[model samples]
Target chain A: MHRDGRAFAHKSSSQQELPMSRAYNFAAGPAALPEPVLRQVQAELLEWDGVRASVAEISHRSPEFMRVATEAEADLRRLLSIPGDYAVLFLSGGATTQQALVALNFAAPGQVADYVVSGHWGKVAIKQAKDYVRANVAASGEAGGFRDIPQAAEWKLSKDAAYVHMTANETIHGVEFRPEWGALPETGDVPLVADFSSSIASEPLDVSRYGVVYAGAQKNLGPVGVTVVIVRRDLLERAGQPRADIFNYASHANAGSMLNTPPSFNWYLAGLVFKWMLAEGGVEEFARRSAEKARLLYAAIDGSDGFYRNEVAPGVRSRMNVPFFLRDDALTAAFLAGAKDAGLLALKGHRVLGGIRASLYNAMPVDGVRALADFMQDFRKRHG
Target chain B: MHRDGRAFAHKSSSQQELPMSRAYNFAAGPAALPEPVLRQVQAELLEWDGVRASVAEISHRSPEFMRVATEAEADLRRLLSIPGDYAVLFLSGGATTQQALVALNFAAPGQVADYVVSGHWGKVAIKQAKDYVRANVAASGEAGGFRDIPQAAEWKLSKDAAYVHMTANETIHGVEFRPEWGALPETGDVPLVADFSSSIASEPLDVSRYGVVYAGAQKNLGPVGVTVVIVRRDLLERAGQPRADIFNYASHANAGSMLNTPPSFNWYLAGLVFKWMLAEGGVEEFARRSAEKARLLYAAIDGSDGFYRNEVAPGVRSRMNVPFFLRDDALTAAFLAGAKDAGLLALKGHRVLGGIRASLYNAMPVDGVRALADFMQDFRKRHG
Candidate 1:
């Protein structure tokens, strides 16, 4: 199929051809890009669609870029099955900015915004929300070291809560919510906002279930700079207080995310990614591949006879991020060095969590996971 | 020199090459990028520094991308000769965000932040600021139809102003502050915050003269997403009340702009641009080339004998944005069509202005300006 080696073959012709042994990056994003999308970006970097200038060098207000922006939003909506009532905003400042924007826009003065603290990102969101509204922690997995999602029954729903915020996947801890919308505790009319930064587009999403689904594009999407915010159109009317034009969601939606010149090049690249995702059978294909990849890696860890261990509960394990540790802490440097030498890159966990985290976003090929699993077995045999 | 034709020659080898006749883009911004920089980006788009992943795909936390970020800041500091006491931040959300940050961070409740409303952008800054602080318009050129900068002597200075704000160049109105630091009205110990979005790096700047200097990279710097903010270190101490982590300049500066994963790709590209500027003899060369380009275009307008007219006063004419008009407004469509056919693109003025604006930023080669001049003269001959 053209989807497989054709993309890799095209890349070889470029001045920056891939090395003989291309490393499978597991960097937890800004992470690995699909080979096809990267090739498309390279092919179009100088002159997009017969335009003499690179997409980055053109005005956002120009017809050329506006078309790209429009097409991108269309493709995204099609992929997510977004309803007509949702406004998909291609914005700057990533998911962190969205954390604050959600609070500032939805939470009125003296109102509480419920936050389910599963891991680091949820905690950060709560901290940022505190500056704007009363951030109420309705449920916290921190007491259990964020190894699993807290039970929905344990969630303390706030009657006067403006919205309930949750992180769909915790990258650092490799904890993820099971992809079942019905599992969420009812919050009546209170909107549900999910930070899907790590796991967006990895599976089929029921867009109608959430009030807002926001993601930073560095993970499963595209590069950094561009952030996707899919918000219920009616929610914009509830936007709290007059704020900076850039921070105000209503103004951004009104301007079609062109209130200020958008990150044009990033937006264009994201469009390419969206096109690639559609061509590859969309999110269903990704979900299948992601589940298979995670199963293979987890089996390898389980079979290692205590050589390797992942702390997250099996039921809540992240298909995207697999964080594990070797039995001997002193062997960390050697493990990393050996992994790099074997053409596996960025396998080191985040600094906050000192171990190995192999993030398998949608772009991560199944073969890459196989390679990592094989490496684990070989490493265990030698080191054990 | 390797700087000249090598870049263009390499670009032609790509699948998406420039046409036989390349157009000179005159969009205010996202504007023209240096051809060499674009080529460098294209060549390295898929693999940077022997890494298999595109620069965008790599983790911002990775040593590979961290080096890119560090080198970018270092090159920018070298190019601008930034002082030790200033923290240079590479942030997202553009200069519009800074307008609010400038007010929110610097101004306490009931405190005033004086703004000089020179043109459209200044008016916008005032509007965004009013949400956060007492936005005092110390001076305005609206009465003069934005034909020139308001005289410094006629300015009102506030005794207890948090800061004084101004736009160094207004892209929409083709107005600019005269390049003389001494001409600025004294504000005692109050900080001078300038939105150098359109004019930054056009000339050598004394970083010590202003408390904060911010510019969106889309203009002369690079593509959109990354905004360069050089702020005095002392100002970090008075960062008003706590706000969103991304909105707080102090937090951004402290994290070295890595708070919640920065726009790594844009930062890397901006670094490439900074390096290109340095290789082409830094800001002084840009200033010299900019002057020559603007002179050619302005002279062409003046020589049109009433066919082409610019309303700005001769003394304060902008060297970056040259907005002019056709004597017969009915011929606007024909003028634009002809210009496009002649390889002059994005010449249509801002919708609000309803004329032609030929923005000559640093990347615009002198030859591009000469081509535009020739096209303008030919257009006048046929239309007159």
Candidate 2:
């Protein structure tokens, strides 16, 4: 089960006796953490780094916590190959808050921000953006049932748009924009803001390509409270006039993300997860394994004889979230129940698109996907 | 040390061996957590309630998490004696975010929101509110060097003001609005909003008096990241038009604080804290203990003839945060260094104040205060 030789025996006594038999959770976000990271957190829960206080109890201003925060930002920057000119902000409120903040900070008064609406997240972003500025849906895939990403050529990107916004990966629809798909033609000097919540750290990314890239640290990162925001230094100048200090990116950057009391414990855990990623050969290895995991699960669905189906286009199928359906809807309940019984949990799809979704985030071991594939085959043989 | 007869043997092997010696953290916020809660978290870090996943790994939508969230809210309601008409929201971005959100939600265009500028936090709130509406300072303690809460008679209550805003306790200045100070006159219909960040859960209050009471769950509650906002149901109707979903109070209320994936682990920890509070006889006992803790520490400062002093008016001195000073300014650094060496962590005052502050939050045991008092007496004797 250990792929990177990075797996060390969990030192916590409670972790040792817990039956190694555990569920392979597939919940979308606030999802499974790397087992080692969880163990490390557990071990350090009572006393962190020989300090008497739990990481959660220490003051964010204390040197001990400041070290954790600085290291987290440094590791994230290193992992992403982020430039010195970019500010790495560990913030709260996840991507949903960022959706509004991005618009508030960048969408200038009387200026349009072009939005490429690909899936549920994109739509949500646009809805939030409209509250602050002219949120123009330059292109939308709703007409095509969000099965695929719309071509850049199809987007009527505004010539003078303040910025261009897109969801790099949509967890609900299992749609992802590959690096090539991220290329917007001839939008002169307009910054690109990407909500990389579900896909961040799952693969290598060109940090310089986007003006802003934010991800909730729930899926591939560590926990739910903290968010990783990598914003190009220059874009900070474009931050709209006099917003709430908490919502102000510049304020956070200036204060080292301790503008107010940060989610200290979450930030520390995220640092641990980042270190684990580095030790395990970085995001490149994660990309390879993530692709393989997606392939295995997709292959199971595609190979099924009219039993299982995935609607996302082959070219843009997400490598992290693989959403599929049982062709005979009647068997879905049985399939999910059996999956749960077999230690496969949270396989149910979004309520809007009901069937199943296997979120294969970085922490989701390849064997978990294989187990799901094996289960899909058995279920099809039993009912198909 | 186990005053409540609740201290259990530290069964975790790691805890059993670590020198039972630990520093007393006197951080203003992101302060101490109950020792028992930390141990419980350490024990349950990997498997929560026999579930084969860490609490952090579980989905917020999962039935198990829903129970935690629901119970947390119920216990908080019971502890605060919150009226049924109040919507208890577990949010993120801390009190700083709520300051802006309150302005965004309650400040109507062209309408003034009266702010009682008592200290640093109140002034900051007033400044943030100015961007959204006419933030009128009805009363200010700044003229008095923030030494005391202004009399209600001195407040220039605006008859048509949108809302009256105040900080129930100023952590930095160590001034608090006692119950009598909180009663505003001739502003019958105008909603009173209080930032109870540092003092919340330290005592019981008549919750129906305020339209909105918000606290960052770092001081007396649990950890950072999660903020508890208890807003009257009627004030929700006044939430201004078309705001960011995350910033909208109604959005959180309608979603039961799950508008987006909440900080689930923080929420769970907060629930544990609420249970701890209940087990320790709720806010009433905390209030009694808090008063006693403050009394002990203040006595040490006051009894030190010209050696140690606190400028804050005795009538308004905060029971949660006690900011003090060494009369011999040159000895301040030595005082802090000696305090830290004696295992009193974060005893230094905030940078702006440049002296000493001993925050006595609910989790701070009376023994910790006694130790601090004894240390203060010894240090004064040596220096004098």
**Segments in model 2 whose C-alpha atoms lie over 4 Å from true places:** A1-20, A179-186, A239-242, B1-20, B179-186, B239-242
| lDDT (10s digit) by residue, model 2, range B268-324 | 989888988888788999999998998899999889997999998878889988898
- Per-candidate TM-score, chain A: 0.94, 0.93
Residues A41-124, candidate 1: write the lDDT tens digits. 666665666666678878888887888899899999998899999999999888998999998898886589899999999999
Query: Which pairs of residues have clashing backbones in candidate 2?
Result: none
For every prediction, compared with the true complex, DockQ reads: 0.38, 0.35
Candidate 2 residue lDDT tens string, A256-330: 998888999899889888987887789999999998998899899889976899988887889888888888898
Best by DockQ: 1
Interface RMSD of each: 11.4, 13.2
Across residues B161-261, which tens digit of lDDT does each residue of candidate 1 receive?
99999999889899887753237876779999999999899999988889999999888897788999999999988958557777788888889889888
Deviation in Å, model 2, residue A190 alpha carbon: 1.3
Q: Please list all clashing residue pairs in model 1, or write none if there are none.
A: none
The backbone clash count of each candidate, in order, is: 0, 0
